[model samples]
Target: MSSRPLEPKDPGLSFGGGARAVLPLTIAVAGFGISYGVLARSAGFPPLAAVVMSATTFAGSAQFASASILEGGGAVASAVTAAVLLNARYGPIGVTVAPVIEGGFWRRFLIAQLVVDESWAIAHRGDGRFDLRRLIGAGLVLYAAWTSSTAVGALGGEFLGDPNVLGLDAAFPALFLALLWPQLRNARAIAAALLGAGIASTLIPVAPPGVPIVAASVACLVGLRR
Candidate 1:
């Protein structure tokens, strides 16, 4: 007797599965978003501007760095430069995910906007394959969580008083560490991370706010040869 062929997975189900897969991460993302909103509000951004920035940029590190720079009375050029540097990692991410994205220019453009580290990581399957539906689903959920949390934080900033007093200031860095910790299973990755941390620590006092991060990113190149 001949066996029936396996049915392809439904796109909607796949998308929902992806969203559920990353649901835990969404909590951390919300915490980070709230921290960013508080920082932006403390940095003198109006409530509307802070929420708008989160909605439009949707880049946590870049937004944080820019807000910090601006708060310190840094030049607009410096703030822009810091944001660019922080976001430079997306260049390779966009390249890696490009083939999986299908559609017209506008659709592709929208997809590109969602290519953050978390979504990209969730979308990448082993063996050089990607799940496009997962990418879009995770991105949509993260974007919504981030923007909504930002609005919550911004609107409630005055009532929250100092985020540090509430211990919310540590949320972003702790979340980042949690994300990075899982990837440090190999010796090379550990080495790169330690090297980056050392470089960033050394530069923190001498360099501008984002320069150390940009410089520390060079340690990632060590993995290219492996």
Candidate 2:
């Protein structure tokens, strides 16, 4: 009797299916990246900074916030504060997906860096059978797509001189709306969102850059658990 799973490793395996599944996610991520690039470039950030962020953080919202703070001539403390607030969601993602990662600490850390929302959705779709190769492959595709798109958009912004008339400002928000739409599938999520929003709106005036997000996240968690 073999204890192994039904599928075994094969060097000849193709990522066509995974690629297809990830295409929409990649395109969506790319769009956000492009938006970020445009905004950052227009804000007077050198192209290299935009590329560095997309390559390093690979997080759309965090990168956007960081760029905004920096572009506003805010100090390093402000930039880090914004980034930390934006990236707090990753801790939850790591907690939820820890069971699926069967690797050492280094591998886990690497994978965690790639555990953005879309990547997590794609990874979890594998039904507890996806190997590391698949996960890594998906992450790489997303990373490349995101970074390269940022570069392209940065260059485009440089050429265009401004994003106002081009309507690039709305791109990231539109993407966020689309990303968030799927999560509102259930009554629990809907309720949580409403509850969180109500609370956060009340707190927004008093809260710092990230307190609202944290407060809302906590409210949603409590709502979901209850």
Candidate 3:
């Protein structure tokens, strides 16, 4: 027998399977994007500004934070600060996902640009058998959903009444709870969330708009380490 080691085999899924994956992702993203758009509009932002944010920033939480800062007469520095803090989670995400990406510089760059929490979660859920095609498909579909929603929101924002009156602001928390509920199978996770919430409540009165989120995230990290 030759001395060469055996190479692992890959299950190359069919195109139909890939489409099945992309469809649900697209629908979810589009719905989230719509909510984001309505919120941006209700916050008194121009439609163009929202679209630009969806295009450049690409992170929903960061974009919303930046928009709030901007609309509140905050300076550009404040917007950047809020966005950076809110989006700090993406850095860790990138670290873990770096190996999954395989491509030339430009392709990798595009993929990185599309690496939000949703895409990362979807990619990881693919059972370690994904390829460039799947990643690209998921990313592009999400991007399209986000951008399309922003556009729709922007268009509607101009002619529409206030979105906040309809409790649009609470959408984020609801989304978070929806995501968190499924992950609460363990005691540690629940404890961490409660600790983080306590920290946030204590800090909210004294801290700035985006600072409580940072503090809570830190608290969660520390709680996890304990």
Comparing 1 with 2 on TM-score, the higher-scoring candidate is 1
- For all predicted structures, in order, the TM-scores are 0.71, 0.67, 0.62
- What would the per-residue lDDT of candidate 1 be over residues 1-226, giving only the tens digit for each residue? 0011112453433677558756767777777777788888888999889999988888988999999988898988988888987787677668778998898999999989987877776665533356888788889899999999898888784454444565555655664565465566677878888999999999989976656766887887776775
CA RMSD of all predictions: 6.5, 6.8, 8.0
Q: Is candidate 1 or candidate 3 better by lDDT?
A: 1
Where is model 1 poorest over a 10-residue stretch in terms of lDDT? 1-10
Estimate, for each residue in 59-80, the C-alpha lDDT of model 2 and write its tens digit: 8878888778877888889888
lDDT of 2: 0.67
Candidate order by decreasing lDDT:
1, 2, 3
Range of the 10 consecutive residues with the lowest summed lDDT in candidate 2 = 1-10
- The numbered model that scores best in lDDT is 1
The Cα local distance difference test for each model comes to 0.75, 0.67, 0.64
- Give the Å shift of residue 187 in candidate 3: 12
* Clashes in predicted model 1: 0
lDDT over C-alpha atoms for residue 94 of model 1: 82
